[model samples]
Target chain A: MTLRTESRFADPDAAYRLLVEAHRKIDPEHGPALDAALVLLLANHIGDPAVLADAIAVAVKVVSPQRQ
Target chain B: MFQFAYRRSPDQDRSSPPRHDVVVVGAGPVGLTLAIDLAQRGRRVLLLDDADRIGEGSRAICFSKRALEVWDRLGVAAPMLAKGVQWQVGKVFLRDEQVYRFDLLAEPGHKMPAFINLQQYYAEAFLVARAGELPGIDLRWKNKVTAVADRGGHVAVTIDTPDGPYELEASHLVACDGARSPIRAMLGAAFIGETFEDQFLIADVKMRAEFPTERWFWFDPPFHTGQSALLHKQPDDVWRIDLQLGRDADPEVERRPERVRPRIERMLGHGDFEFEWISLYRFQCRRMERFVHGRVIFAGDSAHQVSPFGARGANSGVEDAENLAWKLDLTLSGGNAAALLGSYDAERVQAADDNILNSTRATDFIAPHSEYERMLRNVALGLARGHEVGKRMVNAGRLSQPSLYASPLSTPDHDAWDAGPPPGAHLRDVPLGDGFLTDAFRAAGCRFTVLRDGAGPEVPGAAVIDAAASPLFAARYGTRPGDAYLLRPDGYVAGRFRAAAAGAIPAALHRARGAA
Candidate 1:
């Protein structure tokens, strides 16, 4: 199956606020672990390994120092 | 006020109860419907129950369209539909915000709606009243089946009454005893499955509420913090509410009026509601491996059970009755008994699995087992606010629907049809002249019915209905003139063909009757 790339959120800013609000009570050390957990959970929800791998690659390309 | 009169069973004579064609244990909806259907089909049925009166409480409030059709065959749907609340729309919410709404029955021109909310007690009462009218049904109240012995050809059962005990023999013994089935235990059959740890408080309250007669489900509603809630309107101004209590909740404390009243108050925003019945339940999704054990068969809760989320429990049981009644009737009338019962086991086990799968998924979504699961559920719900895909993923009990039996009984499709129900699917009710299609089938007496759109060669041993003049028939069947469909006794399509293929209809009939 093809990986879905269309934006699902109607309001991206509102979704960002929800994501930030989820991490607001977390400490610096726990924050990374929570983020990692969230990533794994989302990956599981995505289910297809190829789609998840593509998503990971896209994130890495966006965050890389050379790209920045 | 209870309308149905409870009559005590006659004292048992020392000799023995007379041998019967079919002895149905437990006088609940399943057993009663089975008995009525069998009696209508010319089988002598003896119905026994330990209870003196109908079931208490507004248990199993939602009856699906298929179940209503089945009850219609048993001659009780008109009263039920008149008394019940029909609804199709369900709204799902995340906390205080409504995420999405769904219309279950989108198509028009159907006889019954997607579902009708009626109390289980009223359903049983209607079935009982219908059963009393049939000549061949012998209903015995306060008579319990204490001992069961599977004799090679028949089942020998012992009944215990207030006065004394009596022995009886039946060609077939059908167990409709509820989840805690003594017959299942007596036969050493295992009822096995998973039990959800989370408990839910179900309260049936009589109130004058302005809430529409629609299903309203909530995930972590503000009234009941961190737990899911459900509200449904039943007949007689009664509202059924379910509140999720965590795994460690004590059943005793959660059932008290002082505790339940506040939860209802928070949801209703008033103290006008009075409790009709309140109970705490930790539902288990379980079933016996084989519904048929020698000459003794199981139906309803005794055969299988699911968590009450999807309203699969009683509706599936009624379907079980519907599926088995005709098979048993044929068996008693010298049809191939073994193969027909085997088909019943295969078809119903598949249905039970389907219900269990849906119920389990709904439970997990409503009460997530782990922190990770909870996190993912929250994300999904958050996404559901705007995304269609996320809204589709939200499972507030995938409500009960009839499962198409992919059994050996169904004669496979010979040619491709674009629309309407396929082979193994129940015949959709369509308006025909002054009445509906099912009404005609009922008047024809639960036989193999062949419907043709226009002039067609008749198949032997099947009743033919000409639907050439009815556009509704043509639309639902997706048939042109001269196309025909072979229907089973239970109103399921056995086979369909464009023209009369020599020997095909008879061969399909043999397979459907389990004579092949």
Candidate 2:
């Protein structure tokens, strides 16, 4: 089955709080490595190449809006 | 809390060494259980341990259903259930938000609960008292094994006591010693596996609190930042708190009350608890290459060890006791020693590997080796907060269960059927008569049992039990009137037949007994 992109949590703030808490203890230089690892883990957990590609495209578009 | 005074035995004064049918080293849960099982089977057992009392601490508080079943067969599950805190619900939280909760025992009608939290000392105490009731068991305290020599037919053991040293010969020697087994060390067997560097502080606190008897786990909670924590309720109004204290935390400093009390106070939001026991441990997943070395056999932590995450250590060890007990009994009763004892090594090794694999995965998730791995773990936890997949992926600990042995002794089924326990799987407890199926199995003595739906052709040389009155039995067994099941003495399904044909029953029983 493909990954669910829409919000599944009952409380969205609770979901957001978990993400913020994950990075509160790490150094700044380790941020990209952490984000990359997160992407890989989430990608595997999602387990669909098509869904991961879609996620990567949306992330790239948000990062470089002018290029799109 | 249980203590026994050491007394001199006749063996110490004998000019020649006395020989025994079975000798079990160490008096922990595994050793005591093994000795009791053998004694119940009418075998004389010499049980020795170095200590004069049950070990201090509330170690191994979680007892699974399989473990309770084993204790039930040994006649000690009643008191343990009475004193233990039984629960099925477990909750996991990510920081301040709870990710999800689960019920371990979803169905009813079973005799035992999903899990019970009882101190290790209580389990050992019950087992020791039961051993005292059996005349076949010779339990000696403060008696240490000074040396062991396997001389082909029998094993020679030298013991040292407070009085003096003595010698004895045993047809079978079982090492139920803890992780650092002196017998294993003397044999020079290599215990090979990986060791996780992360440390955990276990504190048993006694307090009167309103917390439910459920397991609670936190991943990076506000009280314990950047680590994991677990809390569970035990008997005597005591709670067990395990906090992950990174790889570099000094165990000597962390075990002190001043250091442990504050961490617990912050987590509980009060300082009303008193410490009953405090200890530190790191995860080690290791096992001997072979559990059976000639006449000497190894069970429990001496044979294998897993991380404390899954509660597999003592639980699996107890299983080993049951598994080995029957095989040893058969071997002593003139059964094929090579074939029967060989299956014990094969089956228990498979179980140990399964336990090690599960505990290793949980340990890796709990204590990630690198920052990159930590990020992956955090991401999994974050997704768990909102996603069903994340909840399934989180690894607090994969709770212990009985191993369905892929044993050489199991007779493969040729019939196409559904329901009931398959061959080599443990029997599920179902209500029958005034008691349960497990109690009925116990009543059949330590021999193969034939369970049939109704009156069927009697199978020769096997205890027969009729399940005609109980519909649950027919439903659980997926059987009609003539169907039958053959159960091993250790309560595992050996074979099942579509019809209660007496001709085919003997062959299945022969195979189950490892008779060539």
Candidate 3:
């Protein structure tokens, strides 16, 4: 199945808030590591290679918009 | 308490002693189970132990489904099940907050429960009773081995009994002694690995409480802050509690009832329980360089040890007993002794390594070594409250499961299956007729079995269990009408076939028996 661009959560804003709150609970120095680990963990959870590849491309595009 | 009276045996007075087919040392779960299995396989066993009675306390309380299956083959699972507390759910807590609960066995339609908390003494008693019924088993208590010499083809053993010292000869001598194995020391075999400095206090408390029968584990709870704790309900109104007391706590001072009672009261929030047993232990994850040494063999804790976080000690020992028994029996019955015993060495060493790896990992997670490690652990526990991945990362304990043997005896599968237990894996039990698949396998004598979907092939000298009548079997085994699986004597899958040609069965059987 293609990666769904539409938001799946009933409260997308609350989901975002929860992620931020989780980061706040840990020490400031650990935030980046947590994000990296969470990304890897989520990648494992979303085991579909096509969807993961698509999500990665979309995520990288946000940082380098001009990249072909 | 279960007690066995010491009796005088004629072997003690015999000048030449006696030569036996198999002489098994120590009469704990492993020795008892091994002796029974050998006896069932038509080999006479001389089972010896130094102790006259089962040890007190609720040690090794958690017996896994795999262990129960082993006991079932020996005709002792019924008593174990009837007298033990069965559970599948376990909950984890971080500080005072509950993290997430886990269901060990989510899928149903299995013969045995996921786990049962039976006292070690009761388990041994049942095994002893079963051993007594089998005429091939000659169990002698108060018989301790003082010296063991490997005489190439046979083993010479010197025993010390109440009467005096005696000598015996064994074609195969199996040491099922405990962690501090005297035989292991006598042979001067090296047991290598890590030993944790952290100490944990285990107390078996007897009380009338309405707590649900589930494993409750905690990390830094209010009652016992800065350390982890575990609670499990056992049989006979006894609840086992483990409180982490760091490296500095004096085991002698902590073991006293006066010091232990307050901790129980603080944890239970009441002072209405009596201590049945209490002890302190440090984790030791280690194993011998080789489980098999010349004519003398090592099984159970004598061969390997792991941190008790996963209840793997007794369960893995039971699996060791099962794995070793069949191979030894085949060797004694004029099969290739070298090849078969070599398979045993390879298979059980693989299992011991797997157990040590898992238990060591769990212990590492449960008791982190440094501040950074503790922070990472806390991170996982905190994230577990909101994420499924975090729950997967949290390892209070990875409870004992049967080892999937990537063994030399297994004939690698030649056919493809969508979803089923592959070769070198334990067969998942399914409901067959009135009983279960495991029951049928047990009923079909202790030998290699051919489990088929329908009447496709007739394998000589192997018991056959037809899966045509049971749809559940097909579902579990991922089989059509022509599928068949070759099962080892220890219930491990040796090979599988999509369509049997009758001629292909002998070679697979040969490979499974280590005769290839």
Residue B53 alpha-carbon offset, candidate 2, angstroms: 0.8
RMSD of 3: 7.2
- DockQ, cand. 2: 0.07
Q: Candidate 3 on B71-140: residue-level lDDT in tens?
A: 9888999999999999999999877777779898997788899999998999999999999999999999
Q: Clashing pairs in model 1?
A: none
lDDT of 1 at B291: 99
Candidate 3 global lDDT:
0.86
lDDT of 1 by residue, B79-104 (tens): 99999999999999988889879899
Model 3 Cα shift for residue B466 (angstroms): 0.3
> RMSD, each candidate, Å?
6.5, 5.9, 7.2
Q: What order do you get sorting by DockQ, best first?
A: 2, 1, 3
Tell me the tens digit of each residue's lDDT in model 2 across B381-491: 765655664676677888897888898888887676688889988887788899888888888885799988887777677898887677488888888888888899998
Better of 1 and 3 by DockQ: 1
lDDT score, candidate 3, position B247: 79
lDDT for B181 (candidate 1): 97
Instruction: Score chain B of each candidate by TM-score.
Output: 0.97, 0.98, 0.98
Candidate 1 error regions (>4 Å): A1-68, B1-11, B14-17, B500-503
